[model samples]
Target: MKYLAALVIALAAVPATARPQLAITFDDLPAHGPLPAGTTRLAVAQAVIDALKAARVGEVYGFVNGFLTERAPDLPVLELWRAAGLPVGNHGWSHLRLDDVGAAAATVDLDRNEPLVATLAGKTQWHWFRFPFLAEGNDPAMRLAFRHELATRGYRIAGVTMSFGDYLWNPAYARCVAKGDTAAIARLETSYLADAAETATAARTDARSAYGRDTPYVLLMHIGAFDARMLPRLLAQYRRDGFAFTTLAKAESDPVYAADVDPSLPPAASLRERLQAMGKAPAPRTDYAVELATVCT
Candidate 1:
């Protein structure tokens, strides 16, 4: 009977499809913005890359600082990344936030990042651009304007519909557990997972609303402190939820993704600033304590 049970488990592991059908994309790697003032950006980024490798996460869009390119030319982080078979996408030069700037400035930001990504990844075109806060800018006409710039540059501007909400002020919240503060740590863990769940659900809904089909999501997460801790559990959770992780190059290959665009001359400064203004939607509640107070024990 035990042998029969083991055989059943083995059979279940086989692919149900000749080719896997689900796809997911990662945006904003190296998570933090330009190495917080007095730290080694290179070392930090390398650690993050190592974590990504360990997690077995296939591909993600990277927005690297030009400084890293200048200082760590031999690292082959980009080459290794591409060799791992993931397309490199531009996050922006200097990793500047667009909301602080305008269209003309936006163009400059885009130019710097794309070219830098090109320099590092050996790809002439950047497949995706994820804004710092997902906060590109709020003027009604500005959205179209930014898209036009992106189109000209042969780039797809990723609008993140879901996120784990790590950027708002992580570490303090996420590390509460390992630090042995049960209340803070417990809430942090729950919040981290719950935030993703909420984001995924919203993305699914938005995809249905916008595309009239449940469009797979482009999840925006930084390769940061909390994310490193959260990845293993998060990945397992997603797999159980049946979502598949995919490279940016692969994601861009789909027609549903609208990947075709001309590689126009390097974008202008105005456009780059506007690009920085792109911000993400507000996060949903991770109020696990209130929601599951009864069983949290």
Candidate 2:
């Protein structure tokens, strides 16, 4: 679940009685890497699914890398989404942040990611996309140009509203044993919930909040082992918070948002490159904020 960190998060300020619907999404599709628990991405994803079940998660969107999907074709994660009626989309082939490279490079990255996603899903519909990092800058022109490109090729960009910096605590197989961080998993869960609540609180209070009365809060996460490790508690918290989870498609279909199927900014890149390419990023934004927008459930 490696994603470059950046944020283009747009949280609208809205009334408490008019709280927005929320959706949770995970990225680093086809995490076929190793984990401290000696668990593969496959094992971890299944654990996440089980946790979602225990937490009564209704829908999940997995943004997969095309190459990883090819490497681990047997991963049951995709099928889980299918059986559960969840949607699937592309993250990219190598999880590269597209903003770092030149236009040609970005084009190459998008071309590869899109087809891989099409191949994995075996579908020709308007599949959504989650940038490796939410690196799209405030340059409306850049974003519009990218969107037009995607529209030409057939892709819909999934915009995110909030993130809890989960990827920073990715807790891959190696990290798990490195810090003997059993509690790290629990910490990750609690911390993410807190982030969500904090964002919601801000939206509820701020005069310029990005949330609205009819808008649903959109939350972002990842598909890493650490994420799976903490998902049970996370879902429990969502239920505890009185959130009735639903699929991205259903949420987008609702009046809570005006969904579109156009493409988005340049391709994705690593976090550093995306930041360095940050010509017009907002003030004091975390990498998670940008990533959340591009990859939310």
Candidate 3:
């Protein structure tokens, strides 16, 4: 009885395993990259929306670049996305890199995107700002200034914690589809899923290293044709890997996202950022860029 009581106490003292949480967010909506043959921008949007709906994911945010809607054909993608009960946030007007343009120009660019976002977002929270190319700024002072600017504008920075360069596959997939290369497309699918799974494992491992637990992750993706085609399988794989889908707002509500949820806080919202500040190096990720670039050519 004494031994059994001690065993029970020891078991109770061990913490329960933390289930990984993720918020899937899409960028470069209305249009992302070259569409596959026979695919329209609206069709890509519809496919992505269908996948999300089928998966029963909630409140996924599609970050919008208003410049794309200047072309009439691309406008309906936003309409279809909104009609499907998804939310839209700003990704800047021209998708300009803030580091390339100075803070003043980037601020103007961000504001230019607001009118369209405000119209489409309606009553939803449309003040989430995702930096184009995830480039906050090259300069520390500039980054801090831009963050303050975001806070003043009542915007939360949408920080990306998980990504496997999903955008890299879109152009290759398009090339493969154009050439009618089913074998190459199959290769793309395999590589895409492999990278996603590998990156998710790396992200969780890095999170544990930085925070001693897995913080809720916000996944960065683009609404490209390949992404639309693969989202259902991608989401299912995450589920199998023990990730529970969450809203961006809910994921950012975790304390690790304090800087992202409120830009007034000092920047430490990402594992890499935290590790860098701690004088430790973040784990290196496999770059598929070269392989993806040359695959279908």
- Per-residue lDDT tens digits for candidate 1, residues 168-235, read 42445433433556676566677778777776766555444433444435566664555555667777
Report lDDT (Cα) of residue 84, candidate 2: 58
Model 3 CA deviation exceeding 4 Å by range: 1-17, 276-281
TM-score-better candidate, 1 vs 2 = 2
Model 3 superposed RMSD (Cα): 7.0
Model 3, residue 20: C-alpha shift (Å): 0.5
TM-score of each: 0.64, 0.69, 0.92
Lowest summed lDDT across 10 adjacent residues in model 2 is found at 1-10
Q: Scored by CA lDDT, what does every candidate get?
A: 0.53, 0.57, 0.88
Candidate rank order under lDDT: 3, 2, 1
Candidate 1, residue 149: CA error in Å?
A: 2.9
Candidate 1: regions farther than 4 A off: 1-56, 67-86, 97-99, 123-127, 173-183, 209-212, 249-297
lDDT of 3 by residue, 1-297 (tens): 554354335434534346788999999988998988797998888889999999999899999999999889999989898988899999999999988988888899989999999999999999999999998887888888888889999999898999999999999999999899999999999999999999999998887777667778899999999998999999999999999999999888766666687888667535676688778777777888999999879
Stretches of model 2 off by over 4 angstroms after superposition: 1-19, 32-34, 69-85, 123-126, 137-142, 172-192, 203-208, 211-214, 253-260, 263-297
Residue 77's lDDT in candidate 1 = 52
